[model samples]
Target: MRIISGKYAKRNLFTLKSNATRPTSDKVKESLFNSLGQFFSGGKVLDLYAGSGALGIEAVSRGYDQAFLVDVSGQACKIIKKNVDLTKEPERFKVIKTSDFRALKQFAEEGEIFDLVFLDPPYAKEKIIKVMNTLLENNLLAPHALVIAETDEHTDLPEVEGFELKKDHHLGRTKVKVYERT
Candidate 1:
């Protein structure tokens, strides 16, 4: 896969060897950034279940101050590091090789808040609700922060406890939704 816009536009990224990871599509990524608009300027980003780290890398390339990438698999972590190096943005990125969503709480406790959060767990897993709750309970999101979730079109997302659904778009078999703090 490759970065679709910003300074890193057209830059290629490495992918994990395993078939378990599903990277966001170029169309979805472009649409996501377009929807973000001015929100991309100099803000912190958190990419949960980072996989190849494409989404977070895009944010960094577009001028976000920093991106924190968290993933459970060792291979995924390695691929994300490679992708970071590919972008030559090691200083602007942080990779967490952890297996639980709870670790995100530690970031929150450290007073880390993100302007944008990307969640694209494996399809059929229904991980969005659980992670969204953690973000809210930990106050890991900045005021008016945007959280984008890409999932199979059929995944059922509940009304998040403190988040309001801002936008939802279906792209073929995939669905992309944007949520804002209530």
Candidate 2:
């Protein structure tokens, strides 16, 4: 996979030979950033279920102030770190080698709030609702924060609390939903 825009645009990211993660496609990533527009210029970002840190790294490249990438896999974490270093945006991002549950709690305790959050968990897992609740409960989302969720077209996400759906789109087998924290 590769970064499609920003300072690191067209940069190749290290990929792991595992079925544990799915990197967001360039088309989807471009659409996501396009939808975000200036909100990412200097906004704080969180990439939940981060795979190769492609989304978060792209945010940094696009000028986001900072981004936190959280993942449960050691291999993914290693690749994320490498990608950050390679992009030379290490100062703009951090890698959290922990499960979403633990990272959510720690981020909250540390008073880390984000303006944009990317939720792209594994498809067919049905974990988006639980993760959204945790994000709200931990106050990780800043007021009016924009939360983008990418899932398989078949995945049905529950109407989560503390946020209102602003937009929903379907691109072939991919579903993109944008939510604004109320």
Candidate 3:
């Protein structure tokens, strides 16, 4: 896959060779960023289930200050590093090879907060809600932070207390939603 816009526009990214992870398609990525106003002035973003590091990398390329790309798979972490290296600005990204929950805990321990978070997990519905709550509980989200989730059509996102559903888009079998902190 390739970056669709910003500083790294048109740059190709490498994905893992396993079926356990799915990379967001360029169409959806483009449309999602378009909905978020594409380029940003500065902010920190987290790719909670980062597979190929594409989404987080794209965010940084689009002007976010930094991106934390987290993946549970060792292979995916290596691929993430390769993709980050391709950007030639290694400082812009921090790749974590760990489970989603563990990454969140680490962030909490560090008192880190995010302006945006991506929750495209293996199973979306339950995990997404849990992560949202964890983000809220730990104060890991910046004021009015946005949480974006990409999931299968069958996974329906619930109305979490601290977040307001912003946009929901369905593309073929994929369902994407954006939520903002209330």
Candidate 4:
């Protein structure tokens, strides 16, 4: 896969060979970013369930200051490191090899907050709500932080009290929802 826009636009990224991950398609990535404001000025990002670190890398490429890419798979973590290395600014990206919950807890304990977060867990084991709640409870989301959730079309995410659903669209077989903190 390749970055679609910004400083690292068109830069190539590597994907894991295992069937455990599904990299977000270029078309969907472009659409999702467009829906989230096309580009960012500068802010931190978290890519939970990061497959190839594409989403977080794209955010950094498009002007986000830093990104934390977390994945449970060893292969995925290696691929994410390789992809971040391509940017030539590895310092801007941090690859964490751990489960999503553990990563969230670590970030929370460290008083880390993000301006944006990408949640694209495997379709079968969707935990968007649980993750969202953890982020909220831990104060790991900056005021008005934006969250982009990618899921199978069959999944439906309910509206939570502290978040406002900004956009909800179906792109092919995928469902993309953008939520902003209230």
Candidate 5:
């Protein structure tokens, strides 16, 4: 996969060649960013299920100040680090190897807030609402922070009170739902 735009546009990235992870395709990533905003002024982004770190990396490429890429798998973290190295600006990215739950706890402990968060957890283990509630309860979301939740078309994500549905995009079986914090 490769970055589709911004400073790192066209930069090729490494992806895990395993079925355990479904990296977001360039087409969908581009569409998602376009639906929101292509470039950012300055803000931190969190990629909770950073399988290939593509989404977070793409955000940094598009101008987000820093990206925290968290993945449960060691192999994924290694790949993420390698991808970050490709940017030649390793300081702008933080790679963490941990489960989604632990990552959230760590973020809370560190008082880390995010301007954007990408949640694409494994389809079968989806608990988006719970995770979002944590982000909400812990004040992890900056004012009007945007969240992009990617899931298969079959999963019916319920509406959360504090977030407004920004965009509901469909591309074949893949569904991309963007929510903005209120």
Candidate 6:
């Protein structure tokens, strides 16, 4: 896969060799970012279930201040690091090899807040609502923060109290939803 835009536009990224991770396709990534205004001036990004770190890396490429990539798999973490290094600014990314929930808690403890959060967990084990609630409870989102959730067509995400659904669309078998904190 490759970064679709910004400073690192068209740069290739490495993915895991195993089937455990599903990397977001270029077309879907392009559409998702396009819907989010195509670029950012400055902000932090949290990439949970961060497979190959494409979402987070893309955010940094597009002028976001920093990106924190979290994944449960060791191999995925390695791939993420490789991708981040490819950006030539490893300092802008923090790669964590851990469960999404645990990372969320740790970020909360550290009083970290993000302007953008990307969720693309394995389709069969989607826990987006719970994760969103955790982020809310911990005040991990900055005001008007944007949350992008990518899931399979079967996974339906409801509108939660604190978040306003900005856009929801289907790209082939996958579904993409964007939410802004209310």
Give the Å shift of residue 27 in candidate 3. Answer: 0.7
| Clash count for each candidate, listed in order shown | 0, 0, 0, 0, 0, 0
TM-scores, one per candidate: 0.93, 0.93, 0.98, 0.97, 0.97, 0.97
Tens-digit lDDT string for candidate 4 (1-182): 89999999999889988789989999999998887778889999999989999999999999999999999999899999999999999999999999988999999999999999999886433488888888999999999999998888888888876999999989999999899999
lDDT of 1 by residue, 10-76 (tens): 9888887778898888888888788878336698989988999999999989889999999989889
All models: lDDT? Answer: 0.85, 0.85, 0.93, 0.91, 0.90, 0.91
- Which consecutive 10 residues in model 2 have the weakest lDDT in total? 32-41
Task: Give candidate 3's error at residue 99 in angstroms.
Answer: 1.1
| Worst lDDT 10-window in candidate 1 | 121-130
Kindly list the per-residue Cα lDDT of model 6 for residues 31-144, writing each as its tens digit: 888888898999999999899999999988988999999999998999999999899999999999999889999999999999999988765334888888899999999999
- Candidate 1: residue pairs that collide: none
Regions of model 2 farther than 4 Å from truth: 123-125
lDDT of 5 by residue, 70-165 (tens): 999999998999999989999999999999889898999999999999999885324788888889998899999998888888887888889999
The 10-residue segment of model 5 with minimum total lDDT is 122-131
Best by lDDT: 3
As a whole number from 0 to 100, the lDDT of residue 111 in candidate 6 is: 95
Residue 60 lDDT, candidate 2, scale 0-100: 82
* Runs of candidate 4 exceeding 4 Å displacement: 123-126
Give candidates' CA RMSD values in order. Answer: 1.6, 1.6, 0.7, 1.1, 1.1, 1.2
Task: Please give the ranking of all candidate structures by lDDT, highest first, separated by commas.
Answer: 3, 4, 6, 5, 1, 2
